[model samples]
Target: MTRHEETGAALLSVLLLVAVMAVIAATALDRLTLATRIAGSAATVDQGRAYAFAAEQIALRRVGELVRRDPAKLTLAGDWLGRDFTLPLPGGTGRARLADANNCFNLNSLAAETAPGRLSQRSGAIAQFGELMVLLGIDRGEALGIAGAAADWIDSDGNDGPLGAEDGVYRSMQTSYLPANRKMADPSELRAVRGVTPKIYARLRPWICVLPVADPVRLNVNTLAPEQAPLIAMLMPGQIAIGDARAALAARPAGGYGSSVRFWEASSLARLDPGDIAEQTGVTSRWLALTVNVTMGDGFLTAESLIDANGGAPAAGQAAPAIVRRDWGESD
Candidate 1:
């Protein structure tokens, strides 16, 4: 071969080798970048989870202290109930809020018994919820439909509620899902029940809650505020008007109404015909809702928990606050 041909061939081979090395180098760099991102993402998520846990612990401590300090003085107006906590985390920030959950209408109140989904023959909660709808000015038929459907969803019995549908109605839908046949896990579940339009649910959302405890919960009269007057009106039915409810609510002592008797005596409720008023309302709070929001890097995580102040049955020689429920959710 000619000398020029030999040299050119050698040059071409070297060029090809360099190109291959460059390609390999580029791929390795790309993989390294991707792996670094994955590791960083994983670390951020873990940090978020840790922040959430810390927030829960803080809430538990605060709530436990409040409940233990003075059971009688616990009320919705307590500074701790509506306060917000912002914590600085290593890589992000965590925020938490504790709210008075017991003062609201518990959707689980509609359930008759604590066992999954058994309808009660005598639970007044369903009637109270129906009355709430009436006061909200919802169409009577639609309101009844929502209450009845909610009852069927929670009750083990196949009995139909007035204007409510049975499993048959749910099964006929295009999606074809069965009735929960259990207590609602969240107030959002109401949206799934028939006749609960978004608008209706929105109106009711502020006043209602779905507690993990299936037993009926009495409204906290001491914590009840003027904005919550509608609930009181419903509680007393014909006996208490909304203004009277607010009047009674405002008259409560700073610490609280102190007891059902004190609550009855301080406001217009003083004229409640004098019998079993505690059955409908009380000054004590049983449950509180805590929410934690953590922002780590570009991602977000939110956790909600229900703290039972009544200190649920604990093992012998132990005093512990009940964390009734914990749920991961998104900000609305």
Candidate 2:
């Protein structure tokens, strides 16, 4: 071949080699940049989680201290569980808010219905929840349906009652799912039941909680102020108006009722059935919910926990109180 042609061929080969090298360099640079970003994000998330776990320990210890001091004073009116504080962490921040779990109605109580169709009985939580909905201005039939459906999801039997939706009804749906046939796993599960629309669930969410146990929703009157009296009014909705409930709560003695007897005597709730009142009311709190939020750089973490301080404190100079239950809660 001619000298010029050979030179041209060598130059072409060098140019092709350079192009290939450039492509590989560009690809490696992109991958390295992506890996760096991923590592940074992971570090931030790890820090946030560490902060959340630390906050949880603090909350549990606070509850333990309260139980040790005086169980009766464990109500929301006290300073222990009501304190809201922020912690300054290294290159981040974390905060926690404490709320009285008993302040809300226990949705698990609906699963405790003994008589399937006797939903109107004042002794059952189904009846009380139904009445609460009615008092909230919900249609009577819809309220009854919501309560019955809540129970139907729990009861072992597959029978579809007047207001309940059983497996047959659920299976026939377009989504084609089956009934839980057990206690609800979360309050959000209520939206899966019949007649429990998003709107209704939203209205009820603020006032209801899914306690770990299948027990009735008991109101701790001492922790409730006039603003929170609607929970007390929900007990006998047909008889008590929201204003009257507030009045009774406002009339509570300073520092709150000292005991169940004092609570009954100080409020019109004394007029309720002795048995029903005794079964569904208390003067102190057992459950506490804690929400902790942690932020580290671009990462954020939130955790919720339900703490059951059922084990009362020991006599003075004894060991610390025991926690009956502690479980994680759904995300906010």
Residue 179, candidate 2: C-alpha displacement in angstroms: 1.3
lDDT per prediction?
0.76, 0.72
Clash number by candidate, in order: 0, 0
- After superposition, which runs of candidate 2 have C-alpha atoms over 4 Å from their true positions? 1-16, 77-83, 113-123, 267-274, 311-332
Model 2 TM-score, all chains together: 0.85
Q: What's model 2's overall lDDT?
A: 0.72
lDDT of 2 by residue, 108-206 (tens): 677654555322222367778888887777789999988887777777778876577789888888998887776666678888888887788888888
Candidate 1 lDDT, 284-325, residue by residue in tens: 677778889899879888888888776574321135566778
Question: What TM-score does each of the candidates earn?
Answer: 0.84, 0.85
Clashing pairs in 1: none
Q: Candidate 1 — which residues are off by over 4 angstroms?
A: 1-35, 76-78, 114-117, 121-123, 274-277, 314-318
RMSD of 2: 4.1
